[model samples]
Target: MSHTIIVGIDGSDNAQCALKWAISHAQKTDSQIRLISAYTVPGVNMSQADIVYPADFDAAVKKTIEDTAEAAAASVTEAGVPVSTTIVPGDASGVMVEHSKTADLAVVGARGRGGFAGRLLGSVALAMPAHSHCPTVVIPSTWPTRVMPDAPLPIDLPVRASGARTAEADGRDRPDFSGEIVAAVDPFETDTPVLRAAAAQAAIYGTPLRLVGVTATHILAPEWMPSEDHLVKMYDEAAKSFDAAVESLRADFPDLEVRYSIFDAPATEVLVSATYTADLAVIGSRGRGGFVSTILGSTSQGVLSHAVCPVRVVRVTRRQPGRRR
Candidate 1:
């Protein structure tokens, strides 16, 4: 059961950035890097008029994928790390998600052709983190360059090593997340599933949870009246619901630490700023303005694109309610 870091590559500038970040991290952790590039075949029914170079399409596509993978491998090798490349044929997001289930950590770029138009299109990156069998890391294109000056990289953090144990072994100070977990809450209605997910992560990390509720007032501002009090009241009610949700989590995880906060700004800004010094930031995929068909909302997209540290976006799925005995 050796752990490997899987990175999704598409040969784009952003994807290249993700590959570089993954390679450096994999080297430091002594983990093998799996560079994957997926290519989709064009539909058979599409008119030849719409197609370009249909004669050599398959071969060209295969060559492109192989070349991209080789280039990625070469980049890592140049940095003195061993890496393996794989070229798979299928839908990009779906194939990446399937691979993510077995990977120790999956890394992907924040924006790409497969991503959303206006938001971080890192669907494959974000999806794996939400439902992966292992922990995942979504690397933004703007990551800071590696700080290694002159040294062979260290091995990966051992499996089953507790944070405290790792810190003690390294003689390095543990990060203080006692201040707040900063859970972003939607004002329209409190999503219980989202809160529960956030609480679980906070407890695992041993950080105090802070519930933050944000309301958008401009949408409902009537030109004649133009009062923001209605929105404030909505936020207040949502805050109360958030508090109640935290209480429920406390009952389940009795020893869990929790708190609450409220904000009147845009959800994205609130969540992004909250992640500045916080150990982890948690937010829901959908909110008041969420589209029924989308897996992520505008706020989530923004946070994933710009957050300073790791950000977890809770994805709500339908399941049978727990039976009370």
Candidate 2:
């Protein structure tokens, strides 16, 4: 089965960044790209002394949206990837979520033109990850500037690392793997779909899988906590669990590098810190035991908001290893 990556394009530079990421991932996974754009028509009530659009107004707006999708698809096609386009009339986030039902993955920018200035994420970016049927990847608009400062803007271009091969020199399109794939590991929930998704992404990128476990000792402390002994015990327990998980993943992915870390800090602080050197940060939409939920809790929100690299939020329960669809 061919996996389809849904990319929400609103003709914004940020959305272009999302499209570039989708195209790159599609090339690596041998998947198809589905570019989508949504638009809404203002309500016109003839009952009031009010305004009404011309008969062709709606048609013209839809045609423009279709043209935009076509142009984006043409770019993806030129990149040698299977590509298609969908232009619908509705709210952008809702439209994308509706299409996500049949998609294997969804990608969007951290912020869009629809949001007000100073907002870290747009409404669509904020809503899709939590609502999408499949795993959703939100790319930061400043990603290119942060991770690939030297690369061209608003396009898919591999960063040239010291020991990495460049497409121009190797005559092959290869993704940059100088960074690691960081996955948030919940000590309470050792085995989760988030881990599986992160492992798959690590395999896809050919990067190291870093399992990060955070224990909020102070935050979870009792009102009359006596000493640091209890906190130390909690940290020790988390470390062991993280180590075991790392070994398990290493055995499962023999060819891939697997490592683990335990941080006695807030979940958001540690996870966001990991993203500094990560190719992608994967987190669960819900948290049961310790780490804050990505959607329901503030930790995931903080990481997604401030992460320098792209973040993938997984909400589904069982995931097939190494399979995006």
Candidate 3:
């Protein structure tokens, strides 16, 4: 089945990167790409001086939005993917969330034009995964190398904020692009949207699916210390659950290669580490540990901020009983 993928654009290098990623995914999945750019009226303070507005102010704004969307759509057309453009007037995040209700996937950059050097994620990037009705993919600023190695880097490289250092200056290691799709699955939880998405991505890219789970370790409190036997039981149950999940996934995708490992550490840390070598990392919007109704779980938040690879947040919510296009 063909899918409808939404690409949010804002004329930022990061958003351009997102467009590239979305086009590539669309080519692979035989999906259509919808390019959306949101615009808001300029909020200028007119208390000091009386400023006369131009007669064609609204027309100028609409023209600008149309041009921006068209420019982004050019890339999608060149990639031979069916594309549509929508210029909406609203907050970028709100626009994306509203459209995501019918989109198969939503893609955006980790940072946008207004992102501060110290900020790892842009406001839209943070909000989409939490409130999107479909899976939301956040492409990192450093993703060009993985998707298009020969392509030139964006000209407008962001300058570091005061007291900030570059990744190379801090001795950061680059990702290896191991060509495997990784999923941070909750073994004890029966939710399979994350797993199914990861498997489908793996198939699309012709890569192996790596299922990584983390077992909770004992917590130390002033008055309570968990017994060794209790910890052992928990670990054993987690192992069994992991095995069952792996078996089920293997059965579902018979010809696909599926592997799994359980780590005895925090979920966010382990998953973040796994992203260094993964082609893409798929995860659920929320997990079992935090608030039951959290729009975005703490673990997913941490990984999205720091993961070296593109992270897809799969949110399982009640549907309206039919698909949109």
Among these predicted structures, which one has the highest lDDT?
2
| Prediction RMSDs, each to the true structure | 11.2, 8.4, 8.8
The lDDT for every candidate, in the order shown, is: 0.60, 0.72, 0.72
Worst 10 residues of 3 by lDDT: 156-165
TM-score per prediction, in order, is 0.55, 0.82, 0.80
lDDT of 1 by residue, 99-184 (tens): 87767667777666532112444667566645655445555555543222132122222111112112221343322233456666
Tell me the tens digit of each residue's lDDT in model 3 across 1-325: 6899999888787788888989988988899998888877665568966776787886788787788888888878988999999887878888898999889999999887632112667888889888988889999877766433232222111111111112221244322326678887765653377778888788788898877766545234658766778767776676677667667766557788776665555667667766766788998776564211366767778878877789988875432121211
Between prediction 1 and prediction 3, the one with superior lDDT is 3
Better of 1 and 2 by TM-score: 2
- Writing each residue's lDDT as its tens digit, candidate 2 over 1-325 gives 8899999987778888888999999999999999888888878678985786899998998888787788899999999999888877778888888999999999999887642112666788778777889889989887666653233212122111113222331353432333778788775445567877898899989888777766555475477763667666766677677666656666567787776666555677667656655688998777655565435467667777877788999874322232222
> lDDT for model 2, on a 0 to 1 scale?
0.72
